[model samples]
Target: MSEKTNQPLRICMISYRSNPHSGGQGVYIRNLAKALCELGHEVDVLAGPPDPLLEGAARLIPVETLDLYNPEALFRTPRLDELKDPVNLMEWIGTSTMGYPEPFTFGFRAVRHLKDQLHKYDIIHDNQSLSYGIEKLSRKIPTVATIHHPMTVDRRLAVRSVRAPWKKFKHLRWYSFIGMQKRVSRKLPKIITVSEFSKKDIAREYAIDPSRFSVVPNGISTELFHPMPAIPREPGRLIVTNSADMPLKGLYHLLEALHRVSLTHSVRLTVIGKAKEKGGIEKLIKKLNIAHLIDFTGRIDHHQFVREYAKASIAVVPSLYEGFGLPVGEAMATATPVISTTGGALPEVAGDAALLVPPGNSNALAKAICSLLDDPEKRKQLGAAGYNRVHEHFTWKNAAEKTVETYREVIRDYR
Candidate 1:
């Protein structure tokens, strides 16, 4: 509607889940909104399910969805009047059948919520919820979608990891919604992806022209993730952050590597996320007899997680695939040497500063860990390099500035 300028612009950010424990999307929303507000933009984050822990200048708009995974009331239903709309009814059925429906449902709700007040904001930014309803909103307002990475990559890796053909088939069925994402992503006029590696994968998977996408890397909150020079790291203590119990995360492999490392080195692994009681990771830890060597911290506060990072001699990102690798950047920002797998966008984020190993290869991971554990000089060099890399290239302020520029470019072209 108007030219982008030094004056503050009203912006609305949309996310299906803004829970920091859910995934990187929540952290992205929390930090980006704060950064944009710091840059003199009015920011509002409309989120569903889990609430985001955010500070001043950025407002939160909660949109409720039937959280089937909520521990207190699993499989609970929403009030009848709330589901009176025909589209909402369809979404409820779609989710009950077998496919994930929150993205589509949230998009429907977001469009209805913003339809009458379209003039209140300069732009609507969608955070990886590539729903058809998002396509509809793009027609009414200047919209930009940030795809962390393509879901197709996850489906592929999951299928590869499973032993049974039937299990592979089931994985395919669960990710069938990728078809809808592909359709919506192609139609969106503006897109902001986290890394160049993801830009290539998404363009290829969605059959879009590479030139149509823009790359704006996600940032690490240096305020929270920065190195603590006062606290000394414990000897042979390794840390890994895994948000989901998915095979694509490669945590199982990390557990195996840790088991091997313990034979020659007195090491312990501290996992910062939950591992289901009967999950693959838990079983593996027991089988390897590293149950005592591993300490699963379940979930911890942002400050405490960083404090754990401060105590870790090194952090490992053992994912089979990553769109942007926020954990790697976060560890790097904390001045912790990272040993990451060359899966998806990890190499792009790790750069040459951190040690790289092949995904799914536990032996290589063990070797890399042993090398880092033995060489303190190498660790010091990598830690410093990583810190400088993130500060120079991946702070939220820089990310917001680049994103704002992309927003202006898209609006100018659309107008």
Candidate 2:
């Protein structure tokens, strides 16, 4: 590809489900699209519900689908007219069978949308929605995929966390989409992952050669997650941002550590997200009898989320594994001392800025939290170090630039 032809190439970015409040994928799409646009690229985000809030984008083309997972109408059957569409029928059947249909159905819809519009864009970038439809779309256009981490890891963790025969079977069925992801990923020319750990894991899990993968670390939104020094920090206040019921997130382990810490220290634990209703986390909170000492804030807006970090004395990330730990970066960006697990890419993101603990080890988490809580000077030192690391290494502009380089490579290979 000519250097001038690569400059300001039209890009089409696809995300199956992208709501910033829902997870990190939304944040990744919003920030990356904005940053790419700022670099003189025409970008379009084609996504399914809930809609991703993108600012200064070329356009947000909503790829409609059967949003069966909508909280307000969870599992509601699709209308007769909608079911007439083969993709909608597939989604209905898949969801009815306890399988996630978004990735598959979204790809089907996306491919249909992009088929005729293929001439408008230079490259098609898929954000982890590895599906058969994407494989079909890729054959027609220059395409690359981002597999955050193998969903197989999540499935193994979730299945191992549960003991009941039926529940284990359900876990297996729910993650049946991993098979599709594996197949689609291997067929693609290039795969982009957020961390080196993810690149290794994806290669091994999908049996793909490591040479086909590119490692691009995710960026911390410094604009929103930056330090708020004017906001007074609350001593003995510990914060963790996670989806409480996701077994991979290891919230149960964190709760166990909180129980251990509260016995010796007067610490108040605040969870930034809610626990699944009647899920393992809720049951564990009751079983451990630490409900009184913990607070679940459900979901808060970005502004409030940053302030929450500013108010906290320390942040903890207790995930069993992460493709890239966004909470660790966000907490560090906010200048809060962090205690995180060496889970997957947490160490990659945290480096030496945050205290590290073993994954699924409550005692280690408790010790790190206590050590940081007791030493205000140490906390201050770590906070400053983390802020500097974020400013130096993790920025949306850098991530976008690296991503465009990969896009150019993929486009050149396709031709």
Q: Best lDDT goes to which candidate?
A: 2
Q: Which lDDT value does model 1 have at 237?
A: 93
Cα lDDT of all candidates, in order? 0.87, 0.89
Model 1 TM-score is: 0.95
lDDT of 2 by residue, 1-415 (tens): 2346557889899999988765778889999999999899999999998988888755799988888988889999789999999889989999999998789888888978987898888888999999888899888889999888889999999899888999999999999988899888999999999999998998999999999998999998888888888999998999988855888998888999999999899989888878888888889889999899888887788888888898999999999999999999999999999999999999999999999999999999999988888899999999999999999999999999999999988888888
Give the Cα error of residue 384 in candidate 1, in Å: 1.5
**Position 305, candidate 1: lDDT:** 88
Q: Which RMSD values do the candidates have, in order? A: 1.8, 1.3
Tens digit of per-residue lDDT, candidate 1, span 38-135 = 99889888888778876659998887666765666865676698578776676668667666777877888888778787898888899989888789
Task: Rate residue 182 of model 1 by lDDT.
Answer: 93
Which ranges in model 1 have alpha carbons more than 4 Å from their true place? 4-6, 77-88
TM-scores for all candidates?
0.95, 0.98
